[model samples]
Target: MEDAVGYRLRRAQLAVFQQFNEAFAAKDLRPTDFAVLLLLSCNQGLKQSEVAEALGIQRANFVAIVDGLEEKGLVERRKSEKDRRVQALYTTRAGSDYLKELMPIWAEHEERLIARLGGTRERDQLIHLLKRLCD
Candidate 1:
């Protein structure tokens, strides 16, 4: 009787995000940074604007993120061959190696969380339903 669907949903989301934050802290990475790295690795030669759109981040916010990653030398911003005005983003060699090292930890973190949440089926269903809400 006390459970409100909206409130419970928000709480669950926060809890999951918090856990991810904690896990990434071990490698001195923010959740957003990890996501950015993964995105670049998966989609090489994506433009900054494309990354922003794919990640659902505002252009203004993404600028700072790109700056930070570039400063760290984990990402490179190169002028596009086709468009001098546009820059494309790519992960550096160091970034790819760093991601490989953290990949196992990331997998374990996901497994632990899913196990705590009643295992793979429930976790997948939860993610699917959340995506449905956006659609």
Candidate 2:
């Protein structure tokens, strides 16, 4: 069981998420919340469906996530001028500022993980392998 790749990956994911939860506990953010804010920050004006698809989130589940962020003032949905039927997502100014504050914490978290994985070379290799698996 210890040698099984899937089991190992699941365990690693749990540990990483546990660390993440601890680090962001004060801010009351979850991994998925951070991901949505980050994505909106990078790509403004993306339709809800587009964002959901890109994040590999189901539309139904994605709506509740967006609603929560919206209530928190971290994200906003705007009617697309080009398509009235579609709603585009954007990170609020507060969201951008929040991300700026979170950046250092995020960096520290990543550095810790990278160090645990034996530095940049190993980190890069891990990412590459992970990407291959994802693809």
Candidate 3:
């Protein structure tokens, strides 16, 4: 019922994010953690700052987030070969395995939203438009 785009976007985000949290509750992972895992899984090795930037996470909070993931055994950080002072992030075996399990659930979650939006074709176009809005 919200006419404003920002309000509608926020409402959609909240509903979907809550569902994602519930879906991942068994693993005790939050939506943000899932995003970090996703970035680490796809990128072979990246400096922590790069991950944070790509994910739009703040530098100050990202350190603690990565530390928590490291503690959960989902991620590992090492001294970047390019820069000994910077830490590089990679998903651990456990993280990769967890992603395999979560991907299907993520797909299903997306299907529900796509259904509400119309269909696969519409969803794809909508994503393109949304990306444009963000960029």
Candidate 4:
């Protein structure tokens, strides 16, 4: 083999990340930040801990991420109506609007990546293998 799996994966990650960084820079969103917003869009009113767990992010680190999104007016942290002690996360109107714009761009980006990987079939195979590794 010309290279090991880890080396190839790292190189591919770096290449895609560079493209992602450039694509989102104009929108003032990093990939990590985008993940949080996207999560909130799909799971409205999710508890802080739930978001952290779903994202595999440390609770402490996730707080800073949520706080930043709150500061940006992209998301809000509100006291849960059902649980006085828990704060639920939700995307703001502005956040939803941003997502409306970003989703198409995201789709295009994903398509480009899938093409680079060879096609939909190859991309599917890659995802299947990657999921096995992750598990």
Go through the candidates in order and give the clash count of each: 0, 0, 0, 0
Judged by lDDT, which candidate is best?
A: 2
Give the per-residue lDDT digits (tens) of candidate 3, residues 1-135.
569988988898899888888777786778888899888888968998899899899999999998898898889998888889988999999989988898988888778888888999998998898899998
Error of 2 at 42 (Å): 1.1
- For each candidate, the alpha-carbon lDDT, in order, equals 0.90, 0.94, 0.87, 0.89
Clashes of 1: 0
- The model with the greatest TM-score is 2
Q: Candidate 1 residues 48-133, lDDT tens each?
A: 99999998999999999999999999999999888989999999999999999879879988998889989999999989998998
TM-score of each: 0.91, 0.97, 0.92, 0.92
Task: Look at candidate 2 and tell me the lDDT of residue 49.
Answer: 94
Off by over 4 Å in 2: none
Query: Which portions of model 4 miss their true places by more than 4 Å?
Result: none
| Model with the higher lDDT, candidate 2 or 3 | 2
Assess candidate 2 and give its lDDT: 0.94
Report the C-alpha displacement of residue 85, candidate 3, in angstroms: 1.2
